[model samples]
Target: MATKPEGTQATRETEAELARFFARYEPAIMKLGQALRAKLRQRLAGLFEIVYLYERQGSLVLTYSPTERGFEGLCSLALEADGVKLHFGRGAELAKADPGKLLQGRGKTVRHVELRSVADYERPEIEALLVAALQLGNVRPEAGAKGATILKAEEQKQRAARRPTAARTTAARTTAARGAKKAKKARS
Candidate 1:
């Protein structure tokens, strides 16, 4: 039997942790997230992959940085219920880099592109944006160095509260009103 490499077990554990984190999302969304992550790992070769699992928000954020600190992340893949977003950490500062105006966000520093699939990330424009994001962040990954996945937080299984739909909101109000009327009649 061929012995596994030293880091093979750790890599498997990391993948398993990510699999658990992605279980709540739709299959398409999960696939997109994985694709994006694979692409990032390939492109940002020596950068550290910092994973943040937000159980309450029902999201998994994978950030790439030269160091382990998340704040130094050049880019991130934010996986949520609706879709996957490619976030440029210093987007606002990369004004000249985004000639196509592909980025969308009103924030001061961050901007993102909603990725429908890996093809979106492979676009020349998006590739340029990724380069710009890294340049702006001043990340210099050592040539041929392998990056490792760093799980920033332990898994928290708390489910996020879904937004109440209009019908649900109306039904809840009606139910509350009926309860209030019943209490008033009982008091009388």
Candidate 2:
């Protein structure tokens, strides 16, 4: 029977490599995740992408970006084994960090982040994922059909619907207050 994959990156045939990586690092790696989180303290917010850096049994460890703030995802990578994991920064921070640029200029351990723009996504490396998102409508829909007009119309309709009820409520409250005042005057 085919087994579930270990934590290594998967393009297609790397499943076996993943299994090997898991076999090499499994139980110890889980503890590594705990250690990483402890190091980050609670900065482990959930805003950024989490990345795991891998080396040969702690040879060259590097983290690029993580989805969760702090080291949450990084710890997950550590816990999983398939490879080494250390917490990187948030996704935006990672991108802005220009690990690739740093590596290029200074021969940093991290190197060459793959920058995929809307145009660059047409490349083979990303085409499949792009197609999947397209299928899922993850990208914005076309103009006109789901454009700003629809949103503006909905907002206008909501405002128009609210106005009459708000006016009626205000009028009712005023009338009730006036009636109460008249009764008090009569009593006086």
Candidate 3:
């Protein structure tokens, strides 16, 4: 009889582990998504969004028309079952925005539900996020700072945007920016 190497076996085991993790959370995850659907629909009624989910890469992002308050969009909730990593920026900002309004909790995760016209999101928005959190129950979100890279990219973009356009060429004066990330990680 032949046996697989420990490394290969470990990979398979890890895959199985992730599969098991997802299986256990699927029910709760689906239920949470459904409960928030109405609120999400109401808030994101007419907008563009992109949702990506994977054992490693997971995100639910929404981009919409800027409201009077100048909020460009929301990061919403990003979760990974394997790591139980959940980010709570959308709700944190909302909470800070309006007193006695936004939900209070940083370690806990909350998804964005509605847009706020006032300087801060209304109490209802916070309540909605809290509802989502309760539905999610006590799950510790993984804490890791992945935003620094994004900030660097945005800072570079802003710096480029601020530079004066060339005088001679009309194209140079135009302010069209394209997202650029070197296709090959090693750009030699």
Best by lDDT: 1
Give the runs in model 3 whose Cα sits over 4 Å from its true position.
Answer: 1-24, 57-72, 79-95, 101-188
lDDT of 2 by residue, 1-188 (tens): 11122242432333333334334444555345334433333222221222222342342222212321223223222333343333222223333333233212123222222322223323443333323323332233332221100012233346777989999999999999999999999999
- Model 1: residues with Cα > 4 Å off, grouped in runs: 1-6, 142-144, 155-188
Q: Model 1: how far is 117 from its true place, Å? A: 1.1
Q: In model 2, where is the ten-residue run with the lowest total lDDT? A: 144-153
Error of 2 at 37 (Å): 54
Higher-ranked by lDDT: 1 or 3 = 1
Candidate 3's residue-wise lDDT over 47-80, tens digit each?
2222223322442222222221113333343333
Ranking of all candidate structures by their TM-score, best first: 1, 3, 2
- Global lDDT of each model? 0.81, 0.34, 0.35
lDDT of 3: 0.35
- Comparing 1 with 2 on lDDT, the higher-scoring candidate is 1
User: With candidate 1 superimposed using the best TM-score fit, by how many Å does residue 116's alpha carbon deviate from the native?
Assistant: 0.5
32-96 per-residue lDDT for model 1 (tens digits): 88878888888998888888888668789998988777888998999999899988889888767
Off by over 4 Å in 2: 1-150
